[model samples]
Target: MTELLWYGLIINERTVVNMKKKYFLLALLLLVLVFSLTGCVPGDGANNEEHLAGFFWGIWHGWIAPISLIIGIFKDNIRIYEINNIGWWYDLGFYIAVISGFGGLSLSRRRKK
Candidate 1:
């Protein structure tokens, strides 16, 4: 009876750990999906025209610059100026926030487990 009880306890502990890992993976996947879909920020401005340019431009400047820079480095012929633009810092902040928010949630969930 004692051996059976010990085995049951061990199985329960393993099950708990497996559940936590599954939840962590799910959360990470959801985070990546949200970031990719939204371009890592809110409000792309679908209806508003005057502000739409600023919104879309901000998204491109923020997210695209790093990607463009990496590609330019690989290509070795692309100019940095072609990818450069104003208001990039704003987009950087948005990306950081999105990544950090998801990261924080993952950390907290791990801690709880």
Candidate 2:
């Protein structure tokens, strides 16, 4: 009877651990879905200015690449562009942020033991 009880407790602990892992994965997946959807919409460019603005805002919040570059130049860290256009740099930064996030997530998941 004692052996059976010990086995049951061990099984229950493992079940709880598995449940926690499942919930963690579910949350991570939801986060990824939210991030991906924030930038993607179904419509032509002509009718999607609002969506594009929201997408760019999201990119700025996540990456802040343009801001980093500006700060770098101000602090004499790098001299890639003397006159950077906000629109072009923002767009490029947004693309880099999205691709890097997706790739990083994929690589991390793939490397899990």
Candidate 3:
């Protein structure tokens, strides 16, 4: 009787473990699909736009840089920095947003008294 009970417990544990693995795989697949689709967005070198990306675009890109980096890893054309940008102003805005976005998170952390 004890042997049967032990066997049942072991099977239950294995089932639970398999379920967890399946869930993990499902989540991973979803993440890959999302990033892969996002990677397809217009990017790389320069597009046919009449106007290049400016300071606002730089800020937007900088904000989503981390996501772009992940997408870039999977897709060849995705880039973190915009190639079609207005020189110094774009760079300045990118830096500002990047610094503030990341740095602000650190600054906003509450310290325990």
Could you say which candidate leads in lDDT? 3
RMSD to truth, every model: 9.9, 13.9, 5.9
Which residue pairs collide, candidate 3? none
- Candidate 2 residue 35 Cα shift, in angstroms, is 0.3
What lDDT would each prediction earn against the true structure?
A: 0.48, 0.49, 0.76
Candidate 1 on 1-113: residue-level lDDT in tens? Answer: 12225545644666767889999999999998656644422232232434333434444434444444555566664322222223465455545644555566787764443
Candidate 3 C-alpha lDDT tens digits along 2-107: 2225545644566767889999999999998777645433385444356788888778778778878887889887888888777899899888889998999999
User: Which of 1 and 2 is ahead in TM-score?
Assistant: 2
* Candidate 2: clashing pairs of residues: none
TM-scores, all models, native as reference: 0.28, 0.29, 0.58
Choose the strongest candidate by TM-score: 3
Q: Rank the candidates by TM-score, best first.
A: 3, 2, 1
State how far residue 38 of model 1 sits from its true place (Å). 0.2
Count of clashing pairs, candidate 3: 0
Which segments of model 1 are wrong by more than 4 Å? 1-11, 40-113
What are the runs in model 2 whose C-alpha is more than 4 Å off?
Answer: 1-11, 41-113
* Candidate 2 CA-lDDT value: 0.49
Which one wins by TM-score: 2 or 3? 3
List runs of model 3 lying over 4 Å from the truth.
1-50
